[model samples]
Target: MTDTVLASWRDGTAKTAILDFVTRATRQGPDFVPAGDRIATFDNDGTLWVEQPLPPQFDFVFRHWAEEVKADPSLAGRQPYKALIEKDPSFLHGVATQDPQVIESLLKAFARSWAGSTPAEFDAQVREWLATVKQPKLGVLYQDLVYQPMLELFDLLKANGFRVFVCSGGGRDFMRVFAEETWGINKENIIGSAAEYTYTDGGMVRGEQLLGTLDLGPGKPEHIFARTGRLPVFAGGNADVDIEMLSAARFALLINHDDAEREFAYTAAAEASLAKAGELGWTVVSMKDDWSTLYRNREQ
Candidate 1:
């Protein structure tokens, strides 16, 4: 009976939309969703954390690749290694957003760098990266860069029996590392792009080949259905890659990074997603207006 579910959210259309959805989704409500079907999917990177310059996973890949390039100069000429060698901000920005060529190269680099390690080994590598790396402008650890308001939303959805999942364009194993610690979601609920693995010798070993779909853009829905076996009823995202996933949901939430001062702002990367949200009557959450705080550590 208290208006405290999404307390971090300002009283606006964005906040109001979430309240109404949860209320209608309760057991007594006419439009209540079954407990089993109360599925909520979230995108990581720009949606859950800071991804302005580039996704944090890309930073990890670059750092590892840089070390590799140092050991072997020959790897520098490759498609993805070249991008890492240049370390161009523009290229990084392009990869972060929607430059298909740059995105392809980045994905390739990621697939190549992460290959040959077992799941346990891969997780240890990500944990090491998280401990060492910090966001450029935020200057905080990557795990600390998560959005405060979205975290509240996750809690609200969980309290209301919504099964939350992090369906990201980022690596599945990479996200599973922090999904439980950072987002309080089960690692089994995380779904993302994957590297192929084979049962060779004894255990499942990761391969250099990228398997399954890219899990970006149209690939989001494909991967989600493949993993969860159902279309999401509630979906949240920050960029165009999430458009397909959001479109498949009954209640779509789009996080628009319009807060230039508190957080970085960019609409170009998600223009088409924004347009689709408008057409689909999705809730467009304005970071500048809807959220009182930028991140978990800093509250307004």
Candidate 2:
């Protein structure tokens, strides 16, 4: 109920529901959840940051593919590389909608591109990308586009008894590179589609294979349980791929991006999630109405 926490959230049902849930979960009552069992998970893309124009990880990968195509023009004949050369939107549209088939193709190429590279090398490249690249439309770093309200929610949850984790369909190690600094959570708390590794030359190198299922739809809950050993008691997401993770939670928060003035507004991929939220009575926070502020700097 205090403005110090969730300050970006305007006084409304969405904020009230969050606070009330925390109160009930933390208090010694019938609804009280034990500290160890109070796990919260969130989807990273549209839920935590601006995901419109496609997710940021794709931007990073697309740049690499473009360079590869330039070096070997024949590579442009392939599907994904061809997609890049022709400026095709089908593959990217599928990716934006969390199409598993498209993502598998993307990740397989991702693995092949950087196979045998050390984790340190991959991490350094990701760090440099984050540091140097500015989001095209917003004209600011991707890290700066993260929702201020969500960060405040993280602080509130941690202050209570909850341990939070980010579960996404993006590359696991990629998100882990900046998870701690950007989200203020441990790098180990990021769960997503991951590349396997092989120990060679006295160091671990990325293997040319995706480690497990693509982390989307049902895969979201699967990865969360695989890592944390339990389903989330609290969850938040903005897209359809997050359905299973949100469904597994006792408290589900869905973000509705209905503000075009401050942020893009459309539900091309999230239509089902929006319908499901209404059918299930899930809390849907409107970016237009629910947030007093969108970004930390408030200049964009």
Best by lDDT: 2
lDDT of 1 by residue, 69-147 (tens): 8999998898677865787677767877856566666766677777787888888988998998888987778888899
Candidate 2 regions exceeding 4 Å error are none
Least lDDT summed over 10 consecutive residues: which range in candidate 1? 98-107
* Model 2's TM-score against the true structure: 0.97
Best by TM-score: 2
Question: Could you tell me the lDDT of residue 19 within candidate 1?
Answer: 88
RMSD of each: 1.8, 1.1
Which clashing pairs does model 1 show? none
lDDT of each: 0.84, 0.91
Report the lDDT tens digits of candidate 2 across residue range 1-300. 566989889899999999999999999999999999999999999999998787899989988888898899989899789886777788768877768788889988998999989999999989889999999888888888999999999999999979999999999999999888889999889999888998887999999999888998999999999999999999999988898999999999999999999889988878999999999989999999999899876664
Model 1 TM-score?
0.94
lDDT agreement of model 2 with the native: 0.91
